[model samples]
Target: MRTATPPPPPAALTVPEVMTALRLSRSKVYDLLRTNQLKSFTAGCARRIPTEALRQYIDNQMGEAA
Candidate 1:
């Protein structure tokens, strides 16, 4: 018998990753950040979005659609 390995912890996403996940352009992603629709923070000079924040943004969009 063998023990199963635990999954790695979720990490913050970069701007490009967020853009790819949302299927939006670079400008649009920055726009969302600028408008406070998506929440993010800067680590030094790099911008990073928390996984929870991304999920929350998606949930908000679905709620608005419904």
Candidate 2:
């Protein structure tokens, strides 16, 4: 009998987590948030970035490179 595997977690990523994943500095990440380039929302004192937004940002950058 084979059981089904559970799905992965949601796309919520913290500031430091996103910074590490994007290889960007904390200031740069914050600047993105401030400039509305990166989508994010507040969770009390913490902020979270969706994985989709990161993907979109990457796609936009790639498009601009061409």
Candidate 3:
């Protein structure tokens, strides 16, 4: 029998998804977006955050902590 490959992660994440992942409030997530700390873009009036940008933000936070 052949094994099936796992599905890939989303290329972008919703604000609520980010909030849950980062343990942040809705306002805090928007604040990060407004401050440009967390990069995001709009898709037909819906905002989405790229997975890579989220990773970069985490990396930056780690660097700052060190």
Best-fitting candidate, scored by TM-score: 3
Give me the runs in candidate 1 sitting further than 4 Å from their true place.
Answer: 1-6
Return the top candidate by lDDT.
Answer: 3
Candidate 2 ranges beyond 4 A from true positions: 1-9
Candidate lDDT scores, in order, read 0.95, 0.91, 0.98
How much is 60 displaced in model 3, in angstroms?
0.3
Q: Where is model 1 poorest over a 10-residue stretch in terms of lDDT?
A: 7-16
Q: Which lDDT tens digits does candidate 2 get at residues 17-48? A: 88998899999999999999999998998999
- Per-residue alpha-carbon lDDT of model 1 for 1-66, expressed as tens digits? 999999875678999999999999999999999999999999999999999899999999999999
In candidate 3, which residue pairs clash? Answer: none
Candidates 1 and 3 compared: the better one by TM-score is 3
Give the winner by lDDT: 2 or 3: 3
Score every model by TM-score.
0.87, 0.84, 0.95
Evaluate residue 7 in candidate 3 and report its C-alpha lDDT on the 0 to 100 scale.
Answer: 93
- Tens digits of per-residue lDDT for model 3, 1-66: 999999999999999999999999999999999999999999999999999999999999999999
